[model samples]
Target chain A: MSKGWDPGLVLSWTVAVIVAGAFCWLLGDVFWNGLGRVNWQFLTEAPRDAGRSGGIGPIIVSTMLILLVCMAASLPLGVGAAIYLSEFTDSEVGFGRMIRRSLEVLSGVPSIVFGLFGSAFFCIYLGLGFSILAGGLTLACMVLPILIRATEEGFRSVPSEYRLGGAALGMSRTRRLLYLSFPAALPSVVVGFVLGLGRAIAETAALIFTSGYVDRMPSSLFDSGRALSIHIFDTSMNVSGGEAQAYGTAVVLVFTLLSINLAASWITDRWLYRESIGS
Target chain B: MFQFSSDTILFGVLRLCAIAAGSVLLLVFVFLVVESWPALSNVGLVRFFSDESWHPAGENGLFNLLPMLWGTLFVTAGSVLIATPLGIFSAIFCHYYAPSWMARVYRRLIELLAGIPSVVYGLWGLVVLVPLIRELQPPGPSLLAGIVILTLMILPTIALMADAAISNVPKQYLHSAAALGLSRWSTIIGVVVPAARSGLFAGVILGTGRAIGETMAILMVCGNVVQTPSSLFDPIRTLTANIALEMAYALNDHRSALFFSGLLLLLLIIVLASLAETVRVRGEVNV
Candidate 1:
């Protein structure tokens, strides 16, 4: 007998199509309504008018600062740990495995959970009181795991023979790592940084507790500023201008991310591609 | 050897710090349990697990997350239902049908999608999606809204992983199927799908982990309701949203419970991520 019609496939297919359709339409909607909200003043000035639906100057500026702060903290810590682990593996694979596995577990911990810890530890316990430092440190903690993993992968990809050759040529292990291993792995390590920073810029829930969504431009590290992600979240929930303003803010955030992430990804991808291809 | 003393000591401290990263994971569990002990002791473990209402630190102080759990399950299940098939299909097409040039372009777009933040996705949902669903009902931030947003947020991940999985299924398997008088279509369904089942599972697991941990987007779109999802268009909260919405005002037992919830959510991600990672390596072997 011929198999009866498999209705499950049909139903699942419909569901999938509808979901994809909704995402596509949402982007299309943004383009249509979003273009009208964009203006030269919107970029240069803070919300000159009262209420929300304001320009993104402050939020954009805050996000950039947060990125820089998180990068400063995570990069050295992450890369140093990676270098340690990768170098140690030549002699002591057991210790390397422990570091590697821990980094993996750390990466798996959710961002929101990190937000809680950060709030308790950074904002409250340390008396930082909901400021950029708290936000930056929290995001740094979150990104550190990913950065370590990526950098370790980069280091692992470098041929062991090269390191041995350097040692044989009278270069000390430290010098070998600094001049050869590091240089060889620098491109991928940088790629990891770019990826980590892009994620930090988009994060919100974590920032809510640490970053403090206080409106207007930041005066100092402790002054408390709004990030683009938090700004988008805060603007959406409120009743005032409602969906129209929310859409405008979203469009701005999306384009800002699109332009920056696209450039960063292109550069990183080309760098990684060249490394793989030349090898 | 002259300078080695200083540099070696530096590296020694660096090792302690590296090892300390592992301690942080254990520390999280300790901190959550310690901070939340009062509330857990007050409620007792049995009742905490059984109760369905979640109004901790209220006049009632009811801290039942069952409804939120139900909402979490509902939205995650619904999004998975949507993301899985399309991801698998697109992956199949990407693996077998698309030319190299188009494959690269599609891959790049998918990468861009991955790079876009969850908050932006939530923002997009709050703007366009919630209202559209609201047209179906009032207060557009419903379980439907959350599911739709999660589906979009999760699509790039599932597609990328699923593509990797299908690609991992060797050409020999497909060629063997074809040589055995099987049609291309039948060979794909019969041979490729079976071979890639583990990979597909990995993709779905990764996607689920994502949907589960998702906070900002779901928080923005899912109206903060402490009830089981009655309908697709009804407001509901998940564990993530519950923490985000309540944490700002929470204190004592209430805050502890939020910590408990966060701890629980992290444990879930760890479990799912490990499972996904295991399957991913196996899938890679197929390539």
Candidate 2:
């Protein structure tokens, strides 16, 4: 289907290049403006004078804490749900469809709405009172859909022949899933967790409601903490003289996300490589 | 016997997690409704939406949501208008025109774009785009800035979705169109695009939902002026921004009003999402 030069094709392709160029420009702007501020002190030292001076040490720690808690809560539950949907049930049938539809609905619910829900349920009603635990729980709900979908896809990708072979070997369904299917899906599942972690790391609104913006090291999950995204929001919008610090923080957040994404793609490529070899 | 079995226990645990996932949605709805009751009760549901003023000051209560709702709709529509054609064209180019290696790279780039956090987009908009807008029209933050930023923010989603849809179109159609002596571009526009139409519509609808529900990026650049924007340069507040800005200090009915705003956002999202779902299901049925 190699084509001669067509005006429409040229035009569409030009638009694509323009789109890609805009993306590159945006990334270039962020890195060029923000990367200069990064250093050992910036990464390790605590902020002073309402985050105008010093560094984003506590915010980094807080963000990591919330992310760690969120992953801990979401991964097991998400993997379990994915297993149940793809393995235990005929996903085209009643309960599985219901579960999938709920996920779709939940995924579409705005992050700000999740903020409101977290404020109401986790912060106020549940008496968690604006802490890392509260924020992490809110984020767990937020990431659960992505996790389930990815893990379910991973499980589903384990060929039917593998399942048939397991059954033929007189293995029960649960045993086979635990011993064979799940391990095969581990790479994809890890990829999903990294993606979900990227999102959790980036979240500001949902954390705003559940995680109170205390700009110091939190000793426990009950203490309020600041996340990097929220730090960017506060510094850029509310705090004075924080514009530079905000850009610096944005650079950190963006790079952190980039690493996660790179890890995911690497894992995915590795899985593909292994699959190709196995086939 | 089954109760004591490890397999039964494992299945039960998995099923419970699945149910927990679904139940979380239900709980969110219930919490939102309960919290929003005061505003709904005080202002009355009809007047709440219909009244033009949004003042929550002094003795007399006002919880009008029309202006912000209008702002949300306006910004979303503007973003959709800008992004839709560019996204579709990019998707088409990637699918039909670009070399396979280029398409693969484009796909990865789109994924990377999607992975960038919304707040980072906000930071970019605040530092970069807002300044550019300020030069065009003084005082930077306005509906146009919001629109432009949102358009950039959502481009990846729409492009990726359109790409997926176009890729999913069957190869037989292309073969047949080629047999009829249609050129590559003509075959795409005449046959392949038509086949992928409903899927692309679903993507467009989904993108619209993202643009509307978006908070951090738009909030950073939109100037947060609480009024119906009369022009692209006029700064305006969206429903999400209003709640985020005011929810901290809001008290009594004002707090309830914020929840009411959340309820409105939720309803809008539900409508957009279900509509997207319907379009997707319809596309599947057609296939």
Cα RMSD, each candidate: 3.7, 1.8
Task: Mark the regions of model 1 whose C-alpha exceeds 4 Å error after superposition.
Answer: A1-23, A48-53, A90-93, A242-245, A276-279, B58-60, B137-139, B277-287
Colliding residue pairs in candidate 2: none
Writing each residue's lDDT as its tens digit, candidate 1 over B7-111 gives: 687688668667765566666667767766877888766656676567687655778877877888899999999888877776665555556675676666666
Q: Give all candidates' CA lDDT scores.
A: 0.76, 0.87
DockQ metric for all predictions: 0.43, 0.70
Which residue window of length 10 is worst by lDDT in model 1 chain B?
B90-99
TM-scores of the candidates are: 0.90, 0.96
Candidate 1 Cα deviation (angstroms), residue A256: 3.3
- Of all true interface contacts, what fraction is found in model 1? 0.44
Model 2 residue A134 CA deviation (Å) reads 0.7
